[model samples]
Target: DQQVKQNSPSLSVQEGRISILNCDYTNSMFDYFLWYKKYPAEGPTFLISISSIKDKNEDGRFTVFLNKSAKHLSLHIVPSQPGDSAVYFCAASLRGGADGLTFGKGTHLIIQP
Candidate 1:
């Protein structure tokens, strides 16, 4: 089973519009959630993170909301921009640190003029 899943391979949105991406997890053991944005071949950069202890976390234009009961989470980007066009990955930190993070395939977000 997919521990973390981003069903959409891509998303397109107009500039200055709201962009929402959805994610679901199958494992109840996952407690810490994080989102990473990547461009091309570069490694993903941390966007925002929320502890299982908290329901939501926001940073400026980016926001992450978690629904623990549903085992789901989402990322919201306000006033999407062309610069925001890139791949976004949802990740979950397992109990062991040696494995790093369990990541979804990714969602390629395209922002238009």
Candidate 2:
């Protein structure tokens, strides 16, 4: 069974607007959440991460929020740009990320002009 899931396969947002990508998990053992961005022909790169203990984490234009009770998390990209158009993967790991991460199917975010 897929422990991590991204229900929306794609999301479109206007350029300079906020882009929100969502993820949900079935595994309660997960304690860390990480977001990764991937462009064509390139490996996924880490964008931001949040711990289960915290509800929110922000870095630059990106922010991540976790709802432990809901087993859900989201990534927000403010003033999204063309460069922000990519596939975003939501990953989870147990116990401060000591073990390997379990990744979602990925959501393709499209920044439109």
Candidate 3:
């Protein structure tokens, strides 16, 4: 079974609107959650992250919320701009120095004019 899951394949939002992406996981061992944004040909770059100890983390226009009890997490982008359109991947990893991360399928966000 896939440890991490992104139920929605895509989302459309108007410019200056809010964009929300959802993710779920089955592994409780995961303590660190991260969101990555990727463009057409470039690698995914880290956008935001939250630890299991905290319920939320925010950075500029991006925010990540974690619900450990439900094994769920979400990313929210407020006042989304055209440049914010990209594939967002939710990743989870155990707390360690070099452990690999498990990533969700990714949700493509489309911004309309």
Number of clashes in every candidate structure? 0, 0, 0
Best candidate (score: TM-score):
2
Assess every candidate by TM-score.
Answer: 0.94, 0.98, 0.96
Q: After superposition, how far is residue 39 of candidate 1 from its true place, in Å?
A: 0.5
Model 2 Cα lDDT, one tens digit per residue, 1-100: 9999999999999999999999999999899999999999999999999998899999999999999999999999998999999999999999898899
Runs in model 3 deviating more than 4 A are: none
Per-residue lDDT tens digits for candidate 1, residues 70-92, read 99999999989999999999999
Q: Supply candidate 3's per-residue lDDT for 9.
A: 97
List ranges where model 2 is wrong by over 4 Å: none
- List, residue by residue over 48-90, the lDDT tens digit for candidate 3: 9898999999999999999999999999999999999999999
Worst 10 residues of 1 by lDDT: 93-102
The ten-residue window of minimal lDDT in model 2 covers 94-103
In terms of lDDT, model 2 sits at 0.96
In model 1, which regions exceed 4 Å deviation? 95-99
